[model samples]
Target: MSEPLPWYKHFWPWFIVVLLLGVIIKSLVALNIAIDNADSLVSDDYYKEGKAINMDLRKIKQAKNLGMQFLVKVEEHQLIITQHGGPQYKAALQVSFIHPTLEDKDFNVNATADGTGAYRIALSNAITGPWNVRLEGFDNSWRIQQRVVINDDVEYWLN
Candidate 1:
């Protein structure tokens, strides 16, 4: 009777299989290392630190642009005021807008937060020119004054 082939003697098949597996594993490891190193280069702590250092970056960079998710967008031909913050500010929302030209007269509107740190106020009548929108938070005692201009035309949309 012919002797059966031993497991160790299956050189070509085993070598090919092991080589393919090794290549795949090496590629996976390289990818994982690259991802890990990239993540480490810009860690969450570093991001948080950057934001902390520049307080107005988030407000200006995110809020200044239209179609921001969290920032409120004022409609065209209409003036809108919004207040946004955290849980402690649930009780009250006060926003006041005043045109620099009209110093004594200011449009004041009280906004209601929908328990999501976002509040919106719409002016019934349209107002124009350069204005200042001041937002005051009840809980954290935070205040943010944003300058905005309302043009007579062009509808505003938040995406």
Candidate 2:
């Protein structure tokens, strides 16, 4: 038999090299993806956030103690709120619509008293998605918030 060909001429060696190169390339692509899509929900100030959460819990408790209940309605281009049960809230309501992922889509609507315990606000844009609605008084003493999916439904109850 002729002298064995060099190792570089063998099919198995070339196949191994190709697989190793493929793995290296795939790993580089994964590294690039990892760097691009880093976790963003991690807060830098954990202690401060924890303390603030306690404060929010207190505010929520206050709202519950006051027996605040609201019925939010979406009518075409206007949002209507009725405090069906409460101590007759007279203050203007500050409603916050928070998007779970997109910060740019987050907005706030200031609803003024329509009549009696009812409030109304004109929506500047049509909003349809999963949103966190935070209902708070103008003075910001208490807050009621919940995750809701806004669709064609006309009425939503917040307790």
Candidate 1 at 126: error in angstroms?
1.2
Tens digits of per-residue lDDT for model 2 on 23-142? 999999999999988877678999999999999888888889999889988777777888877688887888998999877788887878865657877777777889999999888888
Q: What is the lDDT for 78 in model 2? A: 77
Q: How much is the lDDT of residue 39 in candidate 1?
A: 37
Those runs of model 1 whose alpha carbons end farther than 4 Å from true positions after fitting are: 1-70, 76-89, 115-117, 152-159
lDDT of 1 by residue, 59-118 (tens): 444333422222445564444333333333456656677776655557777777665555
List per-prediction Cα lDDT, in the order shown.
0.58, 0.86
Which residue pairs clash within candidate 2? none
Global Cα lDDT for candidate 2: 0.86
